[model samples]
Target chain A: MMQQERTKVILGVIGADCHAVGNKILEHVITAAGYEVVNLGVLVPQEDFVNAAIETDAKAILVASLYGHGEIDCRGLRGRCEEAGIGDILLYVGGNLVVGKTDFHEVKEKFLEMGYNRVYEPGVLLERVIEDLQQDLQERGLSRD
Target chain B: MELKNKKWTHDQFYAIRGEVLNQWPTGAAVDFAEAVKYHENIPAKKHFAKQLVKAKKNGRTLTQPRAGVALINEHINLLNFLRTEGEADLLPTTIDSYTRQNQYAEAENGIEESKRAGRSLLNGFPAVNHGVAGVRKVIESVNGPLQVRHGTPDARLLGEITLAGGYTAYEGGGISYNIPYAKSVSLEKTIYDWQYCDRLVGIYAEHGIEINREPFGPLTGTLVPPSVSHAVAIIEGILAAEQGVKNITLGYGQCGNLFQDIAAIKALEQLAEEYLNNHGYPDCVLTTVFHQWMGGFPQDEAKAFGVISWGAAAAALAKATKVIVKTPHEALGIPTKEANAQGLKTTRQLINMLADQPFPLSIEVQSEIDIIKAETRCILDKVYELGNGDFAQGTVAAFAAGVLDVPFAPSRYTLNKILPARDNHGAVRLFDIGNLPFTQDIIDFHQAKMNERAKAEGRNASFQMVIDDIYAISKGRLVGRPH
Candidate 1:
């Protein structure tokens, strides 16, 4: 019998966003929960995400942007990923991702429309990402259990 | 930051090491490269040795990002934000100088408006300066080896000023504050108004004390370059002229801190040379603290700990009048009593080590001062830009437009957002000054762990509750605006 593919995720803050306090915390919890994670550090551009995914054959890309300018700075990232031929890679994002004050549902909807498979509002704890990852992996027939 | 001393131990060393290993692994270590040619040395103290050996065998790199992207990039982003938001319509100095350059009426009105906003400046200071009793207790606690001249009459009245320079440094205190003919405002009762200042200068001859004057001197033109920091020095000059007080200390921010600009060094130079000129009383100490605005960038706590300790040591080499070192975990949040105690004791050790090491200032250091002065003056210019015209919500709008050149804003993705990222280059060069005071004697993280152990044993340890309260009470609007 052929061995099944493993669930793996690549995560980082994208575009010109450089905040890392939250990024480090997320990395810690994600690793502890037993998913294989490739953390690309902060200020990753669109191409870096696509390149890392292609290089590592990652199943998803998780983006964190705390500077609040994620809307303007990160709008084209998903499209860039698709162009690099990894359109199927799942995308998850959270943290204080938009500038000024706004509703989180609206933000999630906007990012989802832009092609993210999963979107989290600011202060969405690390475990939520883990649960979503596990569920997604289960559906894909790749859960460790 | 604990206020007392501490020692290092194997278990504590291993504990912080395990945490470090969780991230750097043996194969992912990055930022500590050149400085830590002794990665082997990093793990030597006790438990860390095994981890380091394992990491070395596995080819671990510490995975620290480049400087601008994560470290010094905040400056350029701020600068760009300033440029894009647009320049200030009027220089505060021009208003102070009575130069109605262009749109003179607008300038005149702006000057008037700033004068009205005088109350806004003291956000934490009590509106009424009535807290001299508490201040007197603090003053009494302050001990100095220097004794005053015989027959120096008891001090009757005292005064202190904010010396608000422009930009991030002084902020509107210069031109509007230190007006040459500023009305001689009395202070005996405004302690409630400026309570945060905790400033006290005098007692009104009989019963109560007064801590008067909040003038911000703008020492422009031939006398000296009017950098925001220089404004504080100039104000000190004026304060020294008062005869009532026997001693004074400019309890300024970063007084016990370190920076690329060597700001404390310059402040000391100004104080030493100009104290007598202002006819200030003898024995005013210029103490500094262990603070860094950059620590918030969220690098490894261990590295931050080392940098702050080394920084104060360097500041002392510049011959600090006095110093205060913060505890290692301070950046995590407000320190507990134990943390404060540790911070004090750590600084005491660093100071003791540097005691015999006399500092010699040279033309080279002078050049660094000139560069930093110009750079921050440029920072002031950017701050002025954002003041009037940015259509966006303060800094947020400025960043979206890519008009900001400084990287003060910490985005979630620091790796690409900062260095080689165009606007952040200058900031890297500026902060590089901090790494210059190289030392082999300082055993890096393990040393800190050792000191921490000693501190905990001595009951001087503190655990700071790391505040994750990123939620703005104004619900994320600019402060003072009703949500």
Candidate 2:
């Protein structure tokens, strides 16, 4: 009998936000779903995510920002990834991305242009992210069995 | 900050106004003189301050719901539905996340995107992005008076546009808005920004147009002991009064214990009045608002309604001037307009039924009131002493010294030392006092209450109790017990 390997990912809330409750919930859900999660806790900076992804040989970096400062904190992450020679690493950002009520499309587009692989609305279900990550890994030939 | 409690002089206020009004394009449209004229022409029934006074005089408790949408027409439709179907006596235009953070550019895009999407892209109404004319459209569409509700640390521009657009009431305070909502905003900066907001209200009052100001009372809203909330409310009330605010409502979130909830309302009203009178603002009118449980809600809609109905009962018996309704969809996320209306209608039914009966003044209730008052006095006395009679300066220092700690608040300025847990009856009592300026008697009183619960549960008071109590409501229990 053969078992599939669990995909490892780094998760955290970006910038000066300390919304620990949601971060903890996500950690619990992902771990229970058979994924390896390295949660950096809240108030994480760009370098922290980059270093952790490289250290763990992680496939993705999932960023959550609840304090509406995602635009400022998420900027230049793609550039930082390029500089760190890990630009191919998948980046996903979500949760109250901008301060006001902007269309999630525009938010997603802006983040995608800035190098994020996927962007989510504030209440987007974690299950969607899980499904997408599995598909992305399969497409990239990174899935283990 | 020298605690400039006096109303801002014309030079002081207008000087700041120039910069604040230039923050967004809409700010340029706020003509104060024109806005004052518009407010004067509004019918008395459509004025928030007038309606509140009438409710107080008529001895009726009003109900209000928090609802907002991104698009203009949808927002008006949602509010009208809440007004007619929900039976809300007062209406609110909760601001969107972008506007709350002063990101109007993104809010503008949100408005356009909401139009394209045929649904609200923003959670709340973006009044600032909508500008004065746009907000006036919302005002004209709704029948009842409207208030702006947002968790904004800096509401200077929002205050300018919303008030100019004829909103007669506003909710938030420097301390309440910043500590609970944002992790990194400086308290001193928020306090200064709010001073501008109060002064704007002051100018309106000077022109004989009154606006109602409410200080966000349930800081962090998780098991906040009454005294801690009361102290913050009184401080904010005093700050508003100094800026010529004539009508103020201090609010409290429901704590689930009937006796303690009722006692908190009673004590809040008394303390606000006493503090206002002593501070030489005797003419300032006072009222109370009870927020439905501000902590987590049970996911089951039926169970959520149970929580909602219980809050309505508490608000009615406590005689809060008004009750802020909570929806059945609360735990799920932003509720649909229908769900919001249902919550309001349910509250209306409960309050209407409970109106005829008087709140029972049991000995136990009186004892709760006494304990709340004593605890509040101990904190305020220390606050006053720390300020050396300067309340504002003392407030800054108190937060610095942890004398005014709010549980679970993200502000670094807070001492974060105090911890709260449920008593045997499910009332919130201090678990860890931190650096609160409580007398030995007050400390002993809280200790004994916790011990009662501890003894019953056969566990020593510890941080686990605090964590358990935080999630207790969502798990369908008031007191978290070990499984």
Candidate 3:
């Protein structure tokens, strides 16, 4: 029997963040759930994500920032994605996203306004992410076999 | 370069010293002959190795806290406060991140900015930027013995400046510092660089100044198995002994399981001694340091103290030579001095109360120690075999082949094959053993433990357990039970 092609996803820690544990865990969880994850490890630039998304035609880009500098690192990232011609690609951001104890609702609203399709708080289980990914990919008509 | 576990000749070390001392302008201030004379003048009470030996002899667990600031006077004042208010038996000059990365110009700017702002903008003291004289001023002002603590992959320059300035103990190792701290640094390069740091300590030992050399034992402190850490600690201990370091302190981070934590310290001390003795370093005086929990803490201060006190209790019961204290403001960024003192006093209270009490060698702890020793032996034997009996080469090869993998490390060199999750009783067990050179019985033990937890949770043994365990402590529980 011919093997089915795996759905591709782009994942990395954004900006100067060097928190690789969560990023690596996310990659393992996502890949095990049957996606081909191009994990650009820690300290990744914004362009690298867009470039990888473009190069692999990834269905989604998962951005993680744990250094509490995600706000500054993630600014204008949506615009960069749009400029790179993958404007509609699903974007998910998570982790200790802000510098201090900000309300999760406020943080989520801010990321949504900045073009992320989903924003998760720190400690959100990866299984929940897989479920979200399944539903979102289905809604976008990018479902896998 | 073909790296061997051989000691560097005096000529080779001196040849490299010239280049190392030329790396920054501060390095020029390091006058070895003059530095030796200054070290000789440091009071016996302020000697780190001497204090550790005395503590070990008396069966006391000394307390130490990690503290540092940008400016010299402020740093000295902070150390004095910790010594007096916190009752910290040992003080640390934690190096700033820029200095750890060897960015002296950036660290210099941080110093200027901190001075103008009347506060430290840097996370730690920039000892290299301060040079030997600045370090000496802080050293002279502090009452207790001082240690230079930082997670630097290349600490050659920092070692030179700090040692010349009279700091008696230095922390970090090639494998320990690089695997956990750096994202892209190769193990070979770090192990090679750290050899220089160890050799510098060796030179001090040769001069009858027994500066303590500690291998940072908690590699990627996130749920690391005791065996993995023990293996790395033993390798580093052997490596340091080979370089002529006489006083060595191997350390372990608390794993949250009281029995396992105590057993880890015991196993580490025993394994380190065995490895060092077998490797022909019988004269080396070995000591053990237990680091308080290195994972995420509850944001609430009250809850944070609970975590700190638990660590303190474990350290005390384990009879660690010293316990590295953690502040109550761990979850928050850069704790205030008051909170730091509170953490220390809380720890000291526990240590004092538990001092006369003895922890019985229960079967649980003894079994944990036995298993850890067995697992550590497997890894070390593989490492020795891989290096064709050379630990330095074996360490690099072990990481390359995934035989000695650290869980959740940032380094690209680590295969990232292993996954760790706490068992039903909160003991760390490998959910996925990866390529760790474990025998079938060992693998079966971990698999059985993981299966037991899976059965209890009504869930299959999966990666979710790993994720849950990572956030367990912050959420106020040892095991991440499903709600």
Query: Could you estimate the TM-score for every candidate?
Result: 0.32, 0.85, 0.87
All candidates: interface RMSD: 16.7, 6.0, 4.0
Share of reference contacts kept by candidate 1: 0.04
TM-score of 1: 0.32
**Runs in model 2 lying further than 4 Å from the true structure:** A1-145, B1-3
Tens-place lDDT per residue, model 2, B1-483, is 445556778898888788999999889999999999999998988888888888888879999999888888888999999998888999999887678778788788778877886776676898998899999999999999899998888999999999999999999998888877666778788887888898899899999999999998888878899999999999989988998899998999999999999999999998889989998899998988999998877767899999999999999999999999999877655677888999999999999999999987899899999999998888888888888887777788889998888887766778778989998989999989999988899889889999999999999998768867877887899999877
Show model 1 residue runs off by greater than 4 Å.
A1-6, B1-483
Ranking by DockQ: 3, 2, 1
Candidate 1 iRMSD in angstroms? 16.7
Interface RMSD of 2: 6.0
Model 3 misplaced stretches (Cα beyond 4 Å): A1-18, A26-38, A43-145
Error of 3 at A108 (Å): 12
For every candidate, how close is chain A to the native chain A in TM-score? Answer: 0.89, 0.93, 0.96
Evaluate all candidate structures by whole-model CA lDDT and list the values in order.
0.35, 0.86, 0.88
Provide DockQ values for all models, in the order shown.
0.04, 0.13, 0.21
lDDT of 1 by residue, B370-413 (tens): 55355333323343254342111212222232322222222221
